[model samples]
Target: MLIHGHEVPGAIDEETRCSHYHKENDRIAIKFHCCGKYYPCYKCHVEFGCGKKEVWPKAKFDEKAILCGSCGNELSVNQYFQSGYECPNCKAEFNPGCGLHRELYFET
Candidate 1:
Protein backbone atom coordinates (compact mmCIF):
# COMPACT_ATOMS: atom_id res chain seq x y z
CA MET A 1 0.00 0.00 0.00
CA LEU A 2 1.06 3.60 -0.52
CA ILE A 3 1.07 5.96 2.41
CA HIS A 4 2.03 9.60 2.17
CA GLY A 5 3.51 8.77 -1.24
CA HIS A 6 5.66 5.93 0.01
CA GLU A 7 5.19 2.34 -1.07
CA VAL A 8 4.68 -0.03 1.84
CA PRO A 9 6.02 -3.52 1.42
CA GLY A 10 4.61 -6.78 2.79
CA ALA A 11 1.13 -7.77 3.78
CA ILE A 12 -1.00 -5.60 5.98
CA ASP A 13 -0.58 -7.46 9.17
CA GLU A 14 -2.23 -5.39 11.86
CA GLU A 15 -0.15 -6.94 14.58
CA THR A 16 3.17 -6.06 13.01
CA ARG A 17 2.70 -3.83 9.99
CA CYS A 18 3.06 -0.11 10.61
CA SER A 19 1.77 2.67 8.44
CA HIS A 20 4.11 4.49 6.10
CA TYR A 21 5.56 7.05 8.40
CA HIS A 22 7.69 9.11 6.05
CA LYS A 23 6.86 11.91 3.68
CA GLU A 24 8.43 12.06 0.24
CA ASN A 25 11.21 14.19 1.64
CA ASP A 26 11.54 12.66 5.08
CA ARG A 27 14.34 10.20 5.62
CA ILE A 28 12.99 8.85 8.93
CA ALA A 29 9.82 8.78 10.96
CA ILE A 30 8.58 8.19 14.48
CA LYS A 31 7.04 4.88 15.48
CA PHE A 32 4.09 4.65 17.82
CA HIS A 33 4.91 2.88 21.04
CA CYS A 34 1.27 2.12 21.65
CA CYS A 35 1.17 -0.26 18.74
CA GLY A 36 4.71 -0.64 17.46
CA LYS A 37 3.61 1.18 14.33
CA TYR A 38 5.16 4.08 12.51
CA TYR A 39 3.53 7.23 11.18
CA PRO A 40 4.87 10.40 9.66
CA CYS A 41 3.58 12.27 12.64
CA TYR A 42 0.88 12.27 15.29
CA LYS A 43 -1.48 13.86 12.80
CA CYS A 44 -0.95 11.00 10.45
CA HIS A 45 -1.85 8.55 13.17
CA VAL A 46 -5.08 10.34 14.03
CA GLU A 47 -6.01 10.60 10.37
CA PHE A 48 -5.33 6.97 9.60
CA GLY A 49 -5.61 4.93 12.76
CA CYS A 50 -7.51 4.65 16.00
CA GLY A 51 -6.91 4.90 19.75
CA LYS A 52 -5.34 7.43 22.08
CA LYS A 53 -1.74 8.37 21.46
CA GLU A 54 0.73 6.86 23.90
CA VAL A 55 4.34 7.62 24.57
CA TRP A 56 7.00 5.42 26.01
CA PRO A 57 7.68 5.89 29.67
CA LYS A 58 10.47 8.33 30.37
CA ALA A 59 12.27 5.55 32.14
CA LYS A 60 12.07 3.52 28.96
CA PHE A 61 13.15 6.25 26.60
CA ASP A 62 15.91 3.98 25.44
CA GLU A 63 13.31 1.68 23.95
CA LYS A 64 12.74 1.71 20.21
CA ALA A 65 10.37 4.47 19.26
CA ILE A 66 11.49 5.62 15.85
CA LEU A 67 12.12 4.08 12.52
CA CYS A 68 14.74 4.87 9.92
CA GLY A 69 12.63 4.70 6.78
CA SER A 70 15.76 4.75 4.66
CA CYS A 71 17.20 1.58 6.14
CA GLY A 72 14.37 0.18 8.27
CA ASN A 73 16.39 0.60 11.40
CA GLU A 74 14.44 0.99 14.63
CA LEU A 75 15.82 3.60 17.00
CA SER A 76 15.22 4.33 20.63
CA VAL A 77 13.79 7.71 21.51
CA ASN A 78 16.91 8.61 23.46
CA GLN A 79 19.10 7.70 20.52
CA TYR A 80 17.07 9.78 18.13
CA PHE A 81 17.00 12.71 20.49
CA GLN A 82 20.74 12.63 21.07
CA SER A 83 21.43 12.28 17.36
CA GLY A 84 19.36 15.37 16.64
CA TYR A 85 16.87 13.32 14.65
CA GLU A 86 19.55 11.86 12.40
CA CYS A 87 19.56 8.11 11.82
CA PRO A 88 22.69 6.75 13.37
CA ASN A 89 23.03 3.70 11.16
CA CYS A 90 22.16 5.36 7.84
CA LYS A 91 22.60 9.04 8.69
CA ALA A 92 19.22 9.78 7.16
CA GLU A 93 17.68 13.11 8.02
CA PHE A 94 14.33 13.19 9.77
CA ASN A 95 12.21 16.30 9.83
CA PRO A 96 13.73 18.42 12.58
CA GLY A 97 10.40 20.09 13.16
CA CYS A 98 9.10 16.89 14.67
CA GLY A 99 10.74 17.89 17.90
CA LEU A 100 8.13 20.55 18.34
CA HIS A 101 5.56 17.86 19.06
CA ARG A 102 7.65 15.99 21.56
CA GLU A 103 5.36 16.80 24.45
CA LEU A 104 2.41 15.40 22.59
CA TYR A 105 3.84 11.94 22.68
CA PHE A 106 6.37 12.15 25.44
CA GLU A 107 6.21 12.91 29.12
CA THR A 108 8.02 16.05 30.20
Candidate 2:
Protein backbone atom coordinates (compact mmCIF):
# COMPACT_ATOMS: atom_id res chain seq x y z
CA MET A 1 0.00 0.00 0.00
CA LEU A 2 1.08 3.54 -0.64
CA ILE A 3 0.42 6.26 1.87
CA HIS A 4 1.17 9.81 0.85
CA GLY A 5 3.35 8.54 -1.97
CA HIS A 6 5.48 6.44 0.35
CA GLU A 7 5.27 2.71 -0.15
CA VAL A 8 4.35 0.84 2.96
CA PRO A 9 4.85 -2.82 2.29
CA GLY A 10 2.53 -5.14 4.23
CA ALA A 11 0.24 -2.32 5.19
CA ILE A 12 -3.32 -3.33 5.89
CA ASP A 13 -4.88 0.12 5.81
CA GLU A 14 -4.40 3.65 4.58
CA GLU A 15 -3.18 4.51 8.00
CA THR A 16 -0.22 2.20 7.54
CA ARG A 17 -1.47 -0.27 10.11
CA CYS A 18 -0.59 -3.86 9.41
CA SER A 19 -2.00 -7.31 10.18
CA HIS A 20 0.49 -7.79 13.00
CA TYR A 21 -0.52 -4.53 14.62
CA HIS A 22 -3.74 -2.57 14.03
CA LYS A 23 -4.41 -0.64 17.14
CA GLU A 24 -5.99 2.81 16.79
CA ASN A 25 -2.68 4.48 17.35
CA ASP A 26 -0.70 2.07 15.22
CA ARG A 27 -0.23 4.48 12.39
CA ILE A 28 3.42 4.76 11.57
CA ALA A 29 5.68 3.25 8.92
CA ILE A 30 9.30 2.64 9.61
CA LYS A 31 11.94 2.80 6.88
CA PHE A 32 14.03 -0.30 7.25
CA HIS A 33 17.71 0.41 7.39
CA CYS A 34 18.54 -2.93 5.85
CA CYS A 35 16.73 -2.52 2.54
CA GLY A 36 15.60 1.09 2.47
CA LYS A 37 11.99 -0.01 2.36
CA TYR A 38 9.07 1.09 4.46
CA TYR A 39 7.10 -1.43 6.50
CA PRO A 40 4.38 -1.00 9.02
CA CYS A 41 6.11 -3.10 11.59
CA TYR A 42 9.01 -5.40 12.21
CA LYS A 43 6.88 -8.50 11.69
CA CYS A 44 5.76 -7.20 8.35
CA HIS A 45 9.35 -6.54 7.42
CA VAL A 46 10.21 -10.08 8.43
CA GLU A 47 7.45 -11.38 6.19
CA PHE A 48 7.89 -9.23 3.09
CA GLY A 49 11.30 -7.60 3.36
CA CYS A 50 14.84 -8.57 2.64
CA GLY A 51 16.04 -11.46 4.82
CA LYS A 52 18.65 -9.31 6.49
CA LYS A 53 17.38 -6.87 9.09
CA GLU A 54 19.38 -4.09 10.65
CA VAL A 55 18.50 -1.37 13.11
CA TRP A 56 18.91 2.23 12.04
CA PRO A 57 22.38 3.11 13.12
CA LYS A 58 22.73 5.80 15.76
CA ALA A 59 25.02 7.70 13.43
CA LYS A 60 22.16 8.02 10.97
CA PHE A 61 19.53 9.10 13.46
CA ASP A 62 19.29 12.48 11.80
CA GLU A 63 17.96 10.95 8.62
CA LYS A 64 14.24 10.94 8.07
CA ALA A 65 13.26 7.37 8.78
CA ILE A 66 9.87 7.46 10.44
CA LEU A 67 6.69 8.19 8.51
CA CYS A 68 3.68 9.45 10.39
CA GLY A 69 0.62 7.81 8.93
CA SER A 70 -1.73 10.51 10.15
CA CYS A 71 -0.26 13.45 8.33
CA GLY A 72 2.47 11.96 6.22
CA ASN A 73 5.05 13.69 8.31
CA GLU A 74 8.56 12.45 7.82
CA LEU A 75 10.42 12.41 11.10
CA SER A 76 14.02 11.75 11.80
CA VAL A 77 14.84 9.16 14.41
CA ASN A 78 15.78 11.83 16.91
CA GLN A 79 12.56 13.77 16.31
CA TYR A 80 10.46 10.67 16.79
CA PHE A 81 12.26 9.87 20.02
CA GLN A 82 11.53 13.35 21.32
CA SER A 83 7.92 13.30 20.13
CA GLY A 84 6.57 11.51 23.19
CA TYR A 85 4.70 8.94 21.14
CA GLU A 86 2.77 11.52 19.19
CA CYS A 87 2.90 13.01 15.76
CA PRO A 88 4.43 16.40 16.27
CA ASN A 89 2.98 17.81 13.09
CA CYS A 90 -0.58 16.49 13.22
CA LYS A 91 -0.79 15.88 16.93
CA ALA A 92 -1.91 12.32 16.37
CA GLU A 93 -1.15 9.74 18.94
CA PHE A 94 1.23 6.95 18.12
CA ASN A 95 1.15 3.48 19.61
CA PRO A 96 3.28 3.74 22.66
CA GLY A 97 3.58 -0.02 22.68
CA CYS A 98 6.06 0.39 19.87
CA GLY A 99 8.67 1.24 22.47
CA LEU A 100 8.76 -2.39 23.48
CA HIS A 101 10.41 -3.24 20.18
CA ARG A 102 12.59 -0.17 19.85
CA GLU A 103 15.66 -2.35 19.57
CA LEU A 104 14.25 -3.86 16.41
CA TYR A 105 14.18 -0.57 14.51
CA PHE A 106 16.72 1.64 16.20
CA GLU A 107 20.17 1.36 17.67
CA THR A 108 19.83 1.21 21.42
Candidate 3:
Protein backbone atom coordinates (compact mmCIF):
# COMPACT_ATOMS: atom_id res chain seq x y z
CA MET A 1 0.00 0.00 0.00
CA LEU A 2 1.02 3.58 -0.57
CA ILE A 3 1.22 5.88 2.40
CA HIS A 4 2.09 9.52 1.98
CA GLY A 5 3.27 8.83 -1.58
CA HIS A 6 5.79 6.24 -0.40
CA GLU A 7 5.23 2.59 -1.15
CA VAL A 8 5.03 0.51 2.00
CA PRO A 9 4.75 -2.87 0.33
CA GLY A 10 3.38 -4.83 3.28
CA ALA A 11 1.46 -2.09 4.99
CA ILE A 12 -1.97 -3.01 6.24
CA ASP A 13 -3.21 0.53 6.73
CA GLU A 14 -2.61 4.11 5.77
CA GLU A 15 -0.67 4.56 8.99
CA THR A 16 2.10 2.25 7.77
CA ARG A 17 1.25 -0.52 10.22
CA CYS A 18 1.87 -4.05 9.00
CA SER A 19 0.63 -7.43 10.15
CA HIS A 20 3.93 -8.22 11.83
CA TYR A 21 3.80 -5.16 14.06
CA HIS A 22 0.52 -3.42 14.26
CA LYS A 23 -0.04 -1.12 17.19
CA GLU A 24 -1.44 2.35 17.76
CA ASN A 25 2.00 3.87 17.55
CA ASP A 26 3.38 1.71 14.76
CA ARG A 27 3.27 4.51 12.27
CA ILE A 28 6.55 4.91 10.53
CA ALA A 29 7.94 3.53 7.31
CA ILE A 30 11.62 2.97 6.76
CA LYS A 31 13.43 3.79 3.56
CA PHE A 32 15.66 0.80 3.16
CA HIS A 33 19.17 1.75 2.21
CA CYS A 34 19.61 -1.36 0.11
CA CYS A 35 16.99 -0.59 -2.50
CA GLY A 36 15.85 2.91 -1.53
CA LYS A 37 12.32 1.68 -1.01
CA TYR A 38 9.97 2.23 1.92
CA TYR A 39 8.79 -0.73 3.96
CA PRO A 40 6.71 -0.97 7.07
CA CYS A 41 9.17 -3.24 8.83
CA TYR A 42 12.19 -5.45 8.39
CA LYS A 43 10.02 -8.48 7.87
CA CYS A 44 7.96 -6.63 5.33
CA HIS A 45 11.11 -5.73 3.48
CA VAL A 46 12.28 -9.31 3.58
CA GLU A 47 9.00 -10.44 2.11
CA PHE A 48 8.29 -7.68 -0.40
CA GLY A 49 11.52 -5.88 -1.10
CA CYS A 50 14.59 -6.51 -3.20
CA GLY A 51 16.45 -9.61 -2.09
CA LYS A 52 19.37 -7.68 -0.67
CA LYS A 53 19.17 -5.79 2.60
CA GLU A 54 21.62 -3.19 3.83
CA VAL A 55 21.57 -1.07 6.93
CA TRP A 56 21.83 2.68 6.57
CA PRO A 57 25.42 3.60 7.14
CA LYS A 58 26.36 5.83 10.05
CA ALA A 59 27.97 8.26 7.65
CA LYS A 60 24.63 8.65 5.95
CA PHE A 61 22.66 9.36 9.08
CA ASP A 62 21.83 12.78 7.72
CA GLU A 63 19.84 11.21 4.93
CA LYS A 64 16.06 11.29 5.14
CA ALA A 65 15.28 7.66 5.82
CA ILE A 66 12.19 7.71 7.96
CA LEU A 67 8.67 8.51 6.88
CA CYS A 68 6.16 9.67 9.47
CA GLY A 69 2.83 8.20 8.49
CA SER A 70 0.74 10.70 10.37
CA CYS A 71 1.68 13.78 8.43
CA GLY A 72 3.63 12.48 5.48
CA ASN A 73 6.80 14.00 6.75
CA GLU A 74 10.14 12.61 5.75
CA LEU A 75 12.69 12.78 8.56
CA SER A 76 16.41 12.29 8.43
CA VAL A 77 17.78 9.41 10.41
CA ASN A 78 19.31 11.85 12.84
CA GLN A 79 16.04 13.67 13.28
CA TYR A 80 14.20 10.50 14.00
CA PHE A 81 16.80 9.52 16.55
CA GLN A 82 16.26 12.79 18.33
CA SER A 83 12.49 12.81 18.08
CA GLY A 84 11.73 11.14 21.40
CA TYR A 85 9.58 8.55 19.70
CA GLU A 86 7.21 11.12 18.34
CA CYS A 87 6.77 12.77 14.98
CA PRO A 88 8.26 16.20 15.27
CA ASN A 89 6.21 17.38 12.36
CA CYS A 90 2.84 16.13 13.53
CA LYS A 91 3.19 15.16 17.16
CA ALA A 92 2.19 11.60 16.41
CA GLU A 93 3.61 8.94 18.65
CA PHE A 94 5.92 6.30 17.24
CA ASN A 95 6.49 2.80 18.51
CA PRO A 96 9.29 3.04 21.05
CA GLY A 97 9.79 -0.70 20.69
CA CYS A 98 11.16 -0.07 17.24
CA GLY A 99 14.40 0.99 18.84
CA LEU A 100 15.08 -2.63 19.66
CA HIS A 101 15.39 -3.29 15.95
CA ARG A 102 17.51 -0.28 15.18
CA GLU A 103 20.42 -2.32 13.90
CA LEU A 104 18.16 -3.92 11.36
CA TYR A 105 17.72 -0.66 9.50
CA PHE A 106 20.49 1.55 10.68
CA GLU A 107 24.18 1.16 11.38
CA THR A 108 23.96 1.31 15.12
TM for candidate 2 is: 0.98
Per-candidate TM-score against the hidden true structure:
0.71, 0.98, 0.98
Residues 21-100, model 1: lDDT tens digits:
33443555456667666665676667664567887779989888776666777778888889876778877677776787
Residue-wise lDDT of candidate 3 within 51-78, one digit each (tens)?
8879999999999999998999999999
True-vs-predicted CA distance for residue 28, candidate 2, Å: 0.3
TM-score of 3: 0.98
lDDT of 1 at 33: 66
